[model samples]
Target: MSTDTTLETPSETVSPILKSVNPATGEVIAEWPVHDADAVTAAVGRARVASAAWRELGFDGRKKALLRWVSYLVNHADELSELIRKENGKPLEDAYLELILAVEHTDWAAKHAKKHLSAKKVSPGMLLANFEAVIEERPVGVVGVIGPWNYPIYTPNGSIAYALAAGNAVVFKPSEFTTSIGNYYADAFAKANPELPSGIFSTVNGLGATGAALVASGVDKIAFTGSTATGKRIMAAAAERMTPLVLECGGKDAAIVADDADVNAAADGIAWSSFANSGQTCVGTERIYVVDELADQFVAAFKDKLKTVAPGSGDTATYGPMTMPSQVEVVRSHIADAIAKGGKAVVGGPESVRAPYIEPVVLIDVPEDSLAVTEETFGPTVTIKRVKNNDEAIALANASKYALASTVYSKSKGMEIARQLRVGMTSVNSVLGFAGVAALPFGGVGESGIGRIHGEQGLREFTRPHSIARQKFAIPGMELLSFSRKASTVKLIKQVIKLKHGRHT
Candidate 1:
């Protein structure tokens, strides 16, 4: 899941700095002073003051600035990818892919924000035709963004880039785990446009108090990517002022393999989806529901595919160590519970819980109500269950509190099954495919979170609409809007309404 524990108010320590380390080797990478509420307030004040000038740039101007930043990122992909490998503990190739996706989304937002947020002349209806009507989109001033560490750049860009494209200043607070990456990103924007004001895109470094201060600070909106528990805490704090929020929280995504599916193809797709990036992906598949007919064959194929995948710091490693040390225990507890409850491990077991890395563990016939199946296991482990048919598979999959995203595999019924799954997004034949297409709006319903962060909807999320109505010409002796209206005018209007809208047919 794309979750950051920035809302937890931990006890004070001797040092007022955060140290960034390589999760694989425990090597120190960098450090930054923890910004408290007062520092956070100053940063938000800068963003608020710069917002006016940023909004005055207009669509074309903001688009140019955003594109320049994107170009800078593309040129520095290798450097950034290397940092991600060391700091966040992902393979170099996967880190590069994350950068590529982030660039695609940033570019998409810059190019399309104008088309989506621009003023439009809407239909005023027949009776109101005499008065011209228009709807114009306006930026919601300064926005406060609390980013996630999982996909540091790509996840937060869902808010930062789009907000800037829609003409608003942003004050971002990146997760303490990936502070360097976040600062590099915001610095690139300033480097690209030296003439622009600084606070248009800024960073605040710290943990809970910093994020908490940003929420409490007077900003137009708050965009957060984090855990459901922390998301609830943010809601409680936001309730003080009734602040608007866009939260993308935890997910226990499930993949359904149907009777008509190609066993080999489905196995390959979910293996990567389930274990890639050490299975830390928020939209990654953690649960699998296979038809009884294909259950055994699908299980064997998926297990074999996962055998080649291992976690390490080498160039050939499929993935790296778990980024957060605490998550290793979460994976272990879930596996223990699944085994104690009569589940069979098809791949690896308790021995897989290495300190820095956990090898892939594939379980079969785990209870649906168990922690492994019901909760978001942000690790390299997955559970496979046998279902009678598609009906049973869909029901079990939709039963989770998270309706974030799901995958369906069926040669003939792919689209049909996808349409029925209750989720914000579903991939018919592939896994996590919706993320690459920048035009798709990505968010979930229920406990998964609120609002979206991509495409035209993502652009509009940072703005509000204003309605303007103008009167063109007045008809003689027809004062319908004023008390001076004549009785003849009322009678004629009644006759017209009777003919136009009187019949049900």
Candidate 2:
């Protein structure tokens, strides 16, 4: 049974508190004061004040400060990993890996921001040949980030680090379940760079109301990560203020295996991708389509690999318990619906979804429209279906309304098959390879969410371009801007246009 405790309500306690509980043992790991709408507004105001000074630091200065903070994170990685383990119920190794990824992203953002965001010179059009045009990316002032709990450090840092590097101050509101980790990250950054203005990396802790308040707090822009339904609500709220937003919502990602693929490697990748981090990953494999000839072989290999997988808090455990207790019920409901609708459970079944932990569950021949297949299960559960050929597998993979991430395993035509899937990012022979390469943009199309959060595009997301056109020198015979110019100038312009472009048209 899950021992998770409900957060204290105003009527139940003298003061409202956001408690971070250990999902494995249901122990209260930490508590933070619940910030209300007014408090969130104040934090954004402070960030607005701090943004001026932060922007003044320029790219090099900000990069130095950010690198200092990264050094602190790397130095104290062990302590941070343990904290992640206790609060998120993920294994220590996975927690450490998350930290390493976060640090790498922070480093990348600091080093690459200047190159990507600096002003660039461009040629003026023929009609404005006397003018010099330049485009500069300017910070969007204060940015609000409402982050997710799963992979708390790595996921939120995707926004926080890039925003900071792009010269914007951030007001981050982590998921209610992972508030401590958020606060710790902010605190560490502040300690590493005491000279930075306060509120440059501020945080607001609370539940759903707090996030809504952040959306309504008049921040220059918002970056949110959560469910598609919640993302819609956020869009509605931000619409009132006409604020720009980047919504990184849920994903029903798929993996396609071709008949020509290496069966053993594909099976190993599928099993790991399906169950890693207890399958709570946004880009994790939830649905798989395998070509008919290799379906049985792949399934056998995947099941054989799953037999050694275990869920616990110990060192040797493959994965820990579910980070959110409520998620267990959702996983169970999806599996139950699939089975009731004639899906066959090849490995674990509905009985596997105990509180706190959901063991790996593999279902074969699941109905395409079933909840487990159609929706974001977000657990250690996956559905496998066999298709007639590669074309049918590609069609099935693109059938999801959400197209966040995908994987295609084929020796001869990996990239060819990957190009056919309509997803934001696809790994040819591996899972989530796009995320590790900081140069690639990461986000999705359709219901998966909007905007991106990595690479040059990610840095530019927190900024707006400011174009400047200066009249360097006036042309001797072309006074196009002045009505005082004679009709002869217009005739000459028409003749030049005819000579250059008329023939092509």
Candidate 3:
């Protein structure tokens, strides 16, 4: 991790501030005090103190409190949706969808945590037939969450809800671009449960230094969502204290269209998956592989659908602008590189990339090794490649280092093709279907991320397993090894063991 002290120091005469800007309009929406390293450490200390009482509340108490918080969010959904739209530059409908998922996960975590984490008895082996064994899941003190701007509400709640359900206090550090939304989330929960400790759910707003400080503040666990490079730096910083962390990083997801696929349905699903939220989604499809026999048909259908899709901040727009201004250049560079290397732009090209708002670009005939195909182009752009068969499509999809999410469209072999893709979750004949199902675990393999954040696995991620064993009684005639035992007893025991095992040997 970079230990550069260029950020605001404690002794500075003036405190710094973080400015939240609207990406679509390039206007400053709000300014917040930037919490420095000391502030973050203090927040963690407070949370640690509050965690004791939180754990004492037990499963039922915690569940009631979390549901109250969920009610608050539901009652004020409209106001929260508008704020999300302003901060993220996503369509209003998309913002509402994000809020809905956040609420669902919160409810799921509260309702299921006890059933999954409570103590359960296990049968003892024959050698220990008189013993009883049980296992219990315990909370891991305090947790620090460093969230991303994209899907601001839904993504972070994956950790926050589960951690709180497991009885751990949390100190959240949302992305600088969406700090206000983070404050809103923490404040709403505080208002819903006035009797709860202040640090039970807290927010610290700032840039990179604040996040780095949270990692080293001795939090029991850290849940992070962001780029792979940033995840690496966080992992290195947390290594000093050996703090366990769950990382939900980037993904260059792919979709495969089999020869027998429903071309119209596949096209519609591909368009939405590739361009929704201006292609800012971590699981968005960056690459498409279509069987050779249906490649032309799929492309034609996809282009026709793209004609109706427009990028804007209005309610009618199918998608909106890129939330981060810096991401525009990265998208432009990838598209330019692909075009410069013999790729053809079937719909839009490098020239269509405008700051904040990038018109959807569909590229075809791109080489398999191009940056657009090989890297995570987090923009409203996708590359379509023709494959000789389903096997070839599967091979191309698995070539990337990322394995977060994938999509496959086929009339008969959807499941078979989906099983071959090396990704954490796959949607057959659909895009991003696994995310809507609360029971499914979400996360990835390889560079995509480490650990899970939804369903039963997600709830357990915030807890540690504890096992207990007790002896019921001593068996009679089990003292053959004592000095007083007769030689005849030892011989009988050996003969019994031999009769049971000698035939197999």
Output the number of the TM-score-best candidate: 1
- TM-score of each model, paired residue for residue: 0.98, 0.97, 0.94
**Least well predicted 10-residue stretch by lDDT in candidate 2:** 1-10
Clash pairs, model 2 backbone = none
Tens-digit lDDT string for candidate 3 (112-196): 9989999999997655678899998999999999988888889999999999999999999988888889999999999999998
Provide C-alpha RMSD values for all models, in order. 1.5, 2.8, 3.2
lDDT of 3: 0.89
Q: Residue by residue across 383-488, what tens digits does model 2's lDDT show? A: 9999999999999889989989999999999989988989899998888888888878889989999999988999999999999999998888789888788799
- State in Å the error of residue 107, model 1: 0.8
What does the lDDT come to for candidate 1? 0.90
Ranking by TM-score: 1, 2, 3
lDDT (0-100) at residue 471 of candidate 2?
Answer: 98
Best by lDDT: 1
Model 2 segments more than 4 A misplaced: 1-15
lDDT tens per residue, model 1, 39-66: 7788989998888889999999999999
Evaluate residue 96 in candidate 3 and report its C-alpha lDDT on the 0 to 100 scale: 92
Query: What value of lDDT does candidate 2 attain over all alpha carbons?
Result: 0.89
